[model samples]
Target: MSDVDSELMAGLARMLAAGQQRRAARAQTALETLRSYERRILREAAVMGYVLGYQSGNLDGRTGIGGPLDKNNRIPPDSEILRRVIEHCDSTDDLYPFLAAACDRRRRSITKARRWPGEAGAR
Candidate 1:
């Protein structure tokens, strides 16, 4: 090939490599964000579960009354809930709205229970 053509091909190759690297970096960032959201959602779900269980007297001093607990009698991670959420969601765009709404609802419920302890038993 001519020197000009060789140089042009080399430049194109470098551009392509740089573009791929940028794409990879963006993908890594997106993945990290998704994982962070998942962790936050799981943590919120766990806290909500604990609060509900405590109010309902399940965790007051009882064992084996209500649960999908492990042998150690601990509430397991909410992988099933996360899996179902992921299955129902078409994309991360959809996932965030749904998860955010769920977390908001749980937060409100916890707040209400705290403000009116008597009303908690009515639920």
Candidate 2:
């Protein structure tokens, strides 16, 4: 989640602690919605990463095609195209296993990144 999200959640927690029941409930709902959206985006990123044959631990791999190669830059074309195709694919049932593996890879990446400051923000 972003810094703004963290602030909002903290505010909500404070309001709940202060006994502002109705407002606290509303804020809690908003927090849940924000969390759901965050999860969806991370899932999307994982799908894109997997479709491009990106191994989680190998962030320095070459693409063989011409493009920017910066860790802080946007995802490459092949990944973006693959993600689009996956988005339009009708047979999601077949993609579940791949998505699950991608999610596992993302989780591991996140865990490792968290150990180093500022790496979490890049993911």
Give all TM-scores, in the order shown. Answer: 0.31, 0.21
The list of candidate 1 runs beyond 4 A from truth reads 36-123
RMSD of each: 15.9, 18.9
Task: Kindly list the per-residue Cα lDDT of model 1 for residues 18-116, writing each as its tens digit.
Answer: 966654444333334454655576557655766576456654555454443435555445654444333333234233443333322321223543434
Model 1 gets an lDDT of 0.49
Clashing pairs in 1: none
* C-alpha lDDT of all candidate models, in order: 0.49, 0.45
lDDT of 1 at 38: 56
Best by lDDT: 1
Runs in model 2 lying further than 4 Å from the true structure: 1-41, 44-63, 66-89, 97-123
Q: Over all chains combined, what TM-score does candidate 2 have?
A: 0.21
The residue pairs in collision within model 2 are none
Task: State the RMSD for candidate 1.
Answer: 15.9
